[model samples]
Target: MGKARANTIVANTIVPIAGEDEGDSRLPSRLRKWGSEAHLSSAVARLEALLADRGFERMPWLAVAMLAGIGIWFALPGPGEWLIALGLCGLPAGLALIAMRGDDRALLRNAAVAVPLMIAAGIVLIWARSALIGTEPVAGPRVAVVEALVLEREEQPARDRVRLIVATRDPLDARPIRARLNVPEEMDDPRLTAGAQFRAKLRLIPPQRAAVPGGYDFARAAWFDGLAASGSLLEQPAITREGGGIAGWRSRLAEHVREQVGRFSGTASAAIAATLITGDRGAIPDSDGQAMRDAGLAHMLSISGLHVGAIVAIAWLVVVRVGALFPWLALRVRLPLAAAGTGALAGIAYTLLTGAALPTVRACLAALLVVGALALGRQALSLRLIALAAMGVMLFWPEAVIGPSFQLSFAAVIAIVAFHNSRFVAWLRGKRGEGRGEGRLERLLHAGLLLFLTGLVVEAALTPLVLFHFQRSGVYGSLANVIAIPLMTGLTLPVLIGGLVFDAVGWGAPFWWAGAKSLDLIIALAHGTSSLPGAVLQLPQIALWAVLACVAGGLWLALWSGRLRLWGLAPLAIGLPALFLARPADLLIEQSGRNAALLAPDGRLYLLRNSTSFSAEAMVEAMGKGAQYGVEPFAEFPEWPGARCNGVFCQFEAEGRVLLVAQRPAEVPYGAMVAACARADIVIASRRLPADCQPAMLKADSSLLARRGGLAVDLSNGTTRAVRPQGDRHGW
Candidate 1:
């Protein structure tokens, strides 16, 4: 049988094991004999002894269970009555299992007890979120005349975009609404500053759902952010008032940095510097941003844990040194404590200055935790602390659990911590410690090896996530990081921070100049590495369940201790191969319905719509063809020599099937639909087609596209297979 059949067999086999009751008489006699009460009694005694010796290592498992529950909740199609029924049914069984496992006093320490409690708590968290932030849009899509205050405006090359807080949708009825607007480049309104009031006709629409099945979802993000809708201004606004406050201050700060830094750094470098310093990334060129992502230096573009940690470390060092200059105060006061306090203050100030984005907030929490631990003379970077930090984030922003940054940041740190304390790693270190050599060359080689190994470990841990979210792996990320991280972590961030302080004190020019130069080098490294052969690898889309399985297995490997840890290898083995079994669609149509692409047998992408370059680039990247490498429109950038296109339509043949794309009804060529009904496998018409032309062809018109947001067709098995927006798709 095929791999799919094999997986089905394994899933069928394992699911029963999870569902089987201990006393089920239907179980095989051999299994019943193996799982007799005597065996169960001995297992319980062993578990008790183990707990007595170790004093319950429950935090890691509890945290894992909670995280798993969150993942499960998000993966669910919808929160229906059945979910509550399922939970209600399971809760009693869980309670019974706990009761049978131990007495009341012992239940608190039992993993069996904690697992069910955490799962229920996670379900409750999701249920609460669903109640507070209902899945439905707050307002339907419609045109409205509104008076609004501009919260922020982003200056882009093509046009300017503004975030508005609507004071009233109607003149008589006042209500507050958060929205985003795009103002044309032709309109250079001086009154567009923060808190400036204006009345204009706007088309407000709810956040769009996932374009394709398993695609990006703006609706969830919008719900969390309390964004009512986004739209464009119909005409010049009638100004009502001038503005001031925090929003105004931030705007001025952004403008000042842009003006001052642009003078010395040039527009490109200055844009990068401004984003790092102010968290306004609208000015950064799309090409540069693409390079950063492709080269695996996208982390540097944002203010994250690494940047926050560096800032705190520098603050701590500076405060400690300054204190040393005053011997009297240094002797009387706890210098380290004073330094830690200073670092904590610095972290909080920076977080606020940068708008306190989610990543920054998470980093600040961790930095504060470290400082607090230091003040109390305890270990700062322990597993328990990590668990607590994760729990805290989840308690406040449970939805963040699904975000890429949260997953990547937490996974990297967890892997480092787990490996740093592992017996296998300890044995390796011991072996290294046995060497007495301390030559310069030896030290250099050792450092390089260590960096490479660390990168390998992090990449290994992030593989499933990268493939699931991005579909492309940064193959040369370690090499790129080796050259780029020290420059960023050591020089760029510090110089930038120092430059900001000096600028405030009227002595900043030279520091900003130095930071700009550092950025240029980093950008150069990114471009060079990304241009290297095999620097990025695209993989087939894996199902969410498979990704979650990989996560579960990884957590087991990282969190479990002793012999049980070995079992993690089983899931890892199963999950990795399952990824290959789920192949990419042979053809994909973007949500726009007007744009589509086909996957050539040799792994090239042939786009249908050449006009939609930006969205096409994104689609290409999501398909594992790196933006810089993917083939464009078959007419211009031919990947399939036989592909043909004209002014209004394009046609391509793949896997013995002909697919036709028509930009307009007129492009159909009077009798083409008649031929398509019998000859062509699929016809995608952007505009309405004549009733007679719709004969029996697999017609994908606007109506069909509305129901199935985007389309993915596969013909690898000599039969037509298609994926719709529904969760019924096999892979994703």
Candidate 2:
């Protein structure tokens, strides 16, 4: 009897009695003890225990997996036609699997089966989006007289680019096509503004593909944006008609703000103000833009989550307070619902004013979802809410999945939401009231500390994305954000919002001036921080596979809720080393074949000409150089041992291989060219190569470049492997 009683007692302790607490029942004895000892509150402990319960519900994880699958689908080369057939089959198969298996694991099995279906759906969406854009007309560069209505006009660094919706092509019944027209700086006319219709000769061609491998494909981006062609205006466009409606109002507003700000302040300051108020970034100098990016203040210029959230919050608070003044109204209307509606309206209005750019559209969608959730008495901030927002955005703008803005914005928000909901944060917030009654100074310090912590969290969350996409990480981003974000949010943005409101009644001059003053301070802060040593850390180019792997691991860590989520660390560990191990191309050539660059042994990019600064900057950044190297002009080439240049051509040795960039094929002596090629491993000829001058060396001519776009040579091993931006022209 005694032995049996002891055995029973041991069994009872090992397991749990009926109707016991789920936390104590589900968790191991060690975990329960740790939770108790760690001062975890009962509610937090229960929440965590619930999250850890694998059988509780795993729908959110399944949803996240589907999203990942979709992202992976788009990242691949092209949408496979067979994916549609697969999706059609998988949907029914998933249903059958769920129906046939009534076991506890049925849901998990079903979810696993559904992932490919989701990916297939994504593939279909890509195909649908592409089909929607339609085929481009095979038109060559020719002067065609067309009557075009300007949809938008932006000032480029050297020229003005205008987007026009064609009204009429004089001789041809051309479909209303969206064409990009470049106006030379000298030929820019004040009358050629958005909402104005003009009759002008346009020398246009179908959108061009990426010039080199791994280069940005403007043509692909244009296809998604409904741009049919790009061209130059033969002459200054004559304004034959004026704009009306919303477009006209926006154009007038941009023009008015530009003029007023320019009159009130210096050109640079005015440009800043215009950017803040009217979303006109055209006047901002490249140097200032680069400084802003380096200092991590670039987001402030763009209307993103920060701006959208502020507008909605302010509007909600105002509505709630005003409603509270009338108790009956507040009670009847419900302050939450009223405030949410007001906030949503404000967000929508702001989105429209900003032209509904991708980032702004995403913000608006997220704001609306949050506000709607609040109105519906649901949790307004959760991983589920973020997933919903992401899915909604991807459903409409699938192309955005590849863009940095979408990826970074969503990642930061998800990480923030997850962090706020973590056990550590919960414990910290609980400790807030544990101390003695704090003084005002203590309270302020606490607030500042919280602000700093938030900034740190956001900066860390975005660091990987910044490195992967921009190849430059902001070294002082946390400090910069702590200083600049508050000023922008608490002062500049508020004043700007109020100014826009007051401007309707022509009483916004003071507010605008105050906003401008705040902007000046923000700009100064960015410049100061950027001027610091090592403000930006340029990282070597990370391989696409590594980026994908990291993203997968991060998603696992963030989207799942359990101790098992720690498994994500495995992929992160593998991906980080891969980033360092990956090497960049040895040589880069522009699509035009007019300029090229070589990777120097001293970890610097040696440019053939300064005119290709855009490509050179990309190369330098990829090589982990924070600053661009000097371009060695042919006439003033450095008389180095491995490289030499003359008026006709430039040659350099990299990785024990010599490359010759021929500038003047016709002018260069044939024997000299042949001799140079005979001694070289690669020759990039800007002009046509003579048939008889062929050498054993690899030859890259205008014809090959035209077909390949841009060229990159990988001489990592003993052999030279060339890659093009457009990939194999004849391959799928």
lDDT (10s digit) by residue, model 2, range 1-732: 999999988767755643345455445766678778677546544644454475423545544544555565544444353455456647776775755464544444455566656666666665576677644543555568777887776655312444344434423545667777777776666566666788788887777665445445666777787776777778877879865666556656766665655655555666766666556677777677777888888888788898888889889999999999998897788899889999999889978886777889899999999999989998888888887788787778777887888888888887788777777677777787786687899877777777677777777667777787777777787788887888887887787777777889999888778777777777788889988998886776677778777777787777665586788888888876786576767776766677665666665556566544566555555556534534243222234355677767777766677777787888878787778778877778777776655544567778776666667777555433333333332121
**Prediction 2 TM-score vs. true:** 0.84
Instruction: Give me the runs in candidate 1 sitting further than 4 Å from their true place.
Output: 1-35, 47-57, 85-89, 92-94, 97-109, 134-141, 155-176, 188-191, 424-449, 578-582, 628-633, 636-662, 665-683, 687-699, 716-732
- What tens digits encode model 1's per-residue C-alpha lDDT throughout 177-261? 5776777755547567777888878777766656545666666677776666666778878888987776566666766776766
| Model 2 CA deviation exceeding 4 Å by range | 1-75, 78-100, 134-139, 155-176, 258-266, 504-506, 580-582, 629-646, 667-679, 688-697, 718-732
Q: Cα RMSD to native, each candidate?
A: 9.4, 8.6
- TM-score for each of the candidates: 0.83, 0.84
Candidate 1: minimum summed lDDT over ten consecutive residues — where? 723-732
Residue 188 Cα positional deviation in candidate 2, in Å, after optimal superposition: 2.7
